[model samples]
Target: MSTIVIKRSQAVWQDRTRAYTAWVDGKAVGRLEHGASLSVPVGAGEHEVQMRIDWCTSPALSVSVPVGGTVELECGPNANALLALLYITLWRHRYIWLKPATTE
Candidate 1:
């Protein structure tokens, strides 16, 4: 057995009003607030992960964890531009981006 640490932060300062829900294999694992994180223990194998806020959701992320290994993932709103925000809000589009968390 291994642990998959799903670390998520509301990196977008403007969208801190809502908390994003982290989903693993279609089940709600935990809720992530601004500058928050969650740790999930999973068996050694592949898993599906995603973040959802309102009607928008990030794309399914495929992750594989080795025995006794850990995987770090991050999620945040794509606040790079105004149009992107509009697309996310108006179109019910997903502007949240998920990626492997970088070690600082």
Candidate 2:
């Protein structure tokens, strides 16, 4: 088995109290809270992951995991307080961000 680990950031001013739904291969697996990390097990190979709340969702993140390997990802709302309105009204689907963790 392989693991998809997702770490969510803490956004004090944006959706701080809400939880994002974690999706793997288009199925809702669990709720990922702010500033929390979750691990979802999957068969080895490629998969698509997403984090979303209602109409707001991050771009899909594609990953390949070897047998017994792990893929780490980070996600959060892309909209800050100032950009929240714009994101809500314009790019609802891009309101969140999901990507491979490089900056840590």
Q: Provide the TM-score for each candidate, comma-separated.
A: 0.83, 0.93
**Looking at candidate 1, what is the lDDT of residue 75?**
84
TM-score of 1: 0.83
Writing each residue's lDDT as its tens digit, candidate 1 over 3-90 gives 7676666564646877888888889988888878888888889999898887888878999989999999988876556566574776
Candidate 2's TM-score: 0.93
For all predictions, the C-alpha RMSD in Å is: 2.2, 1.3
Question: Which residue segments of model 1 deviate by more than 4 Å?
Answer: 10-12, 89-93
Q: Top TM-score: which candidate number?
A: 2
> Residue 48 of candidate 2: its Cα lDDT?
93
